[model samples]
Target: MAAGPGRYSKRVRRQQDILQILAQEPTMRVKALAARLEVTTETIRRDLEELAEQGLISRTYGGAMLRAEAEPALSQRERELVKEREAIARSAFRQCAHGKTFMIGSGATTAILAKRLAFELRNVTVIAHSFAVAMALAQNPTIRIIMAPGIYHAGEGAMHGAQTIRFLQDYAADWAILGASALSPDGPSDALFEAADVYGTMLRQASHNMIVADHSKFDRMATARYAQWSEIETLVSDRRPEGPLMRALERREVQFILAEG
Candidate 1:
């Protein structure tokens, strides 16, 4: 078992305290951290140095910033926030009425929705670009899966290219159930600019749009826009939004659904 703060080494305790502070505040000055942790400034500096060397944080001018990049990729996302995504997907799945046809997009949250639709729902046709989405539904013979042809993107677990965009342009769906790498009141955006055109085309071709994303993506930035707030019919997520994004959703009259986390 891991030792308590008193039983463990001071170095371990101090580092844990440092991470807790950083979690509340993205950046912290060494002097402030020292005072908060009731440690000498020199000790705080050493801790910061060790954390930086371990890539836990980034050293700044007289301070350290949280190393957001230290967080792992999609699989890491699935592992860390899997429950939240699963709950959000469950809430989003309620909209997936049996016999409804939709074009589902690639993303971790959407991947969860794919599993639910595959096992829990029936007789649904899904046009998707994600290999993950396709494979998730592969076991169910009742669910028809249509793959959009394109160059496979290993990192995204999906396919995308000019061909994918062309196919999306030619196709239409009852709804475009999508996901975003980042989102704001400005609407949903994609981190993969190469596939942004394909997402945009898919969005336009669909009669209605639903976005399933977690609150962590609320204010995050991405390269290209997929759909505007006005374009989306519903927003499904783990938590209700805050700040400017919240106001925008209200003004647009978008139906926002919160899933239990």
Candidate 2:
């Protein structure tokens, strides 16, 4: 059967979905993809083979992975993960309902949450470091937007560096709504050093921290560690994580929420 607005077959639609998943996380196990897509392992294997032949993915022992540099650029990443991020953001946004002020960071996921606040949230103040986020909240009449001082990194669509940390240090917020460049069992992280520093400050400056990441973030990797699993009060994602990662989050007492599409 065809899916979405386009007349796409089962195979083509599945392949398209696979690319979006790969855009978020470079690697994907065949079994996991099969479960998520509601297909058999053999079917996923066949799809992987086709994608590999087309130079879209490289096959692994039981799965496939995108080349490190093959990950989508900032704009592309946002476009591909639209549905997942929307779901994740909706859940994360609800958590900040009781708070009067927030410390929101950058990224596609954060941007979605920003839009919700601009349209729906009332009488709130936001301390933000991302230009994209600021623009979104500007549409609302009540929410106050504070831009953190720093060098704006256009590539990340956010601000970072020593100045940002210094600026964030001067204030405390009720909640910090943030995103990860990549997430692993180690916790949430970003590949950029400056971003890591800014997020680290955001984590401490807020009394509560809620992480919004799509499930694909689990298979992604990044160098700069921003917070430990225990440090996160809640994690909202498009899908539930696998067993070990789920267990780890539970052990750390992080409230994990799977946002439905």
- Per-prediction CA RMSD (Å): 8.3, 9.6
Cα shift from native, residue 50, model 2 (Å): 28
TM-score of 1: 0.72
lDDT: worst 10-residue window of model 1: 66-75
lDDT of 2 by residue, 1-261 (tens): 535555347688899899888776556789899999999999889889998887676665677765323334467677877988988877887887788889998888898899988878888999999888898899997988999888978777778888889999999999999888666556787767888888889899899999998866675446567988989999999888874467769899999888977
lDDT of 1 by residue, 149-245 (tens): 9998877878899989888777788888888876655677777786577778777888878899887777544656677888888999998887557
Give the deviation of candidate 2 from the true structure as CA RMSD: 9.6
Model 1 clashing-pair count: 0
Report the Cα lDDT for residue 130, model 2. Answer: 88
